[model samples]
Target: MTGYRRVLAHLREDVLGVLEPGDGLPPERELAIRFGVARMTVRRALDELATEGLIDRLVGVGTFVAYPKRNIHVQLTSYTEEMTRRGMIPTATVLDFGAVAASDHVARQLRLEPGDAVLRYRRLFYADGQPMSVDENFLVPQHVPGMAKASPPPSLYRYLSEEYGLVIDWGEDTIEATSATPSLARLLTIDARDPLLKIERRAYVGRVIVDFSVSYYRADRYRLSVPLQRPRRAQQHRPVLRGR
Candidate 1:
């Protein structure tokens, strides 16, 4: 007799492993027949998978594999470029923007004096209509006069290059994990205390700090990916045997 474990193993290897989000699972009767098991056994296996967040069960609808979290490259790029590379439509909402005195933290990142006038802006980044991150950025106003205007350009980096002849040649990024704030929870559609990935970036042109940004991304929906390579060693002319 085929037990639920056998059915589960087969499904995990054949169906769940290959299926993408929104891909429907076969009916319980079909799975039972395919696995040579009772229908009850098939249901039990699916129930366990649903509890593990690997699949979703909808009333009057078949089960489906859940979407895995998206992995983003850890390189310096705009949100628009990243989301576009993932085949998702990217958009941003300007939550807040105005001239504000720099906080101690912002001042340190931007190399400005405390309480110095700087432009502070907040934007909500989206991928395929789902909120992905919230960014709070600060910048000195002396270089980019167009920033003082009421409306912001679609792409901040593009705007800086086109309008001010400035470019982000290099940057420093710091990453950490933290709990979501109330506003962040609401905008990110996650629980108040859920884990979030915080990124602090300082973009620079030559020796000048152009922009400093603090961003929070949903941990459950986003992940950072990086490539690793082994360093090459110097050539060894001859191998000398050491004491065993």
Candidate 2:
């Protein structure tokens, strides 16, 4: 076996096997010395490990075991439910809450007039005590009256279902890639211009639009998992030939 391959196998099996996620690995020179390989070989091995998602190489910061990315399945469940299903504690902090005049875009989504009052709120969500995402939501005031005055609920879906009987029947989501701004960087504890997964959703209770929300998720920590199914082909009718 070649030197780098041997070093890669040894590091993958012996070194990383004992280390927990976020645990730092030895420097390249130390690894090279320990494995009796060239420093270039050690770097190559580490690069392969990083490509396989087993480790993270940060500039100026040494390499460390990478945390497994959480899969966010495309479903109707709320963030609280999703985190709980993944065996992580979920918590939320309400950053801002107030009634505001709906903008043209938000009003169109919520089926309200542009100048109509809407409850606007911002929330920071955490999973296992780590900040996961930030959500900004606009709701029609008539549907969720007094929500601004009341303490924010742990789960908005649960609150809507139980208190107001406004269960979300369906939702449409538009997803895009975005970069974190300075303000968002502070809230999410990430560097400015870091990649983020942006999801804008319009949720409906029957035919009535209940909520329109925009969520920004750290791309490194979360990934989308969507299940796809092939559509059935339509039957083709051929012209029947009579007696020729």
Clashes of 2: 0
Worst lDDT 10-window in candidate 2: 235-244
User: What are the clashing pairs of model 2?
Assistant: none
Kindly list the per-residue Cα lDDT of model 1 for residues 103-219, writing each as its tens digit. Answer: 899998888899998998888988888888898878899977757775876777777877888877777678899999898999988779878999887887777988898889887
Number of backbone collisions per candidate, in order? 0, 0
lDDT of each: 0.78, 0.82
- Tens-digit lDDT track of model 2 for 1-244: 9998899998898545788877899999899889898999999999999898888898898998876779877766777777888899988899988998989999888888898999987899888888888998888888987888998776777788899998776777788999999999999998999899998888877667788998899987888887666555796322111000
Regions more than 4 Å wrong, model 2: 13-17, 59-62, 113-115, 232-244
lDDT of 2: 0.82
Native-referenced Cα lDDT, model 1:
0.78
Report each candidate's C-alpha RMSD, comma-separated, in the order given: 9.5, 9.0
Q: After superposition, how far is residue 73 of candidate 2 from its true place, in Å?
A: 1.0
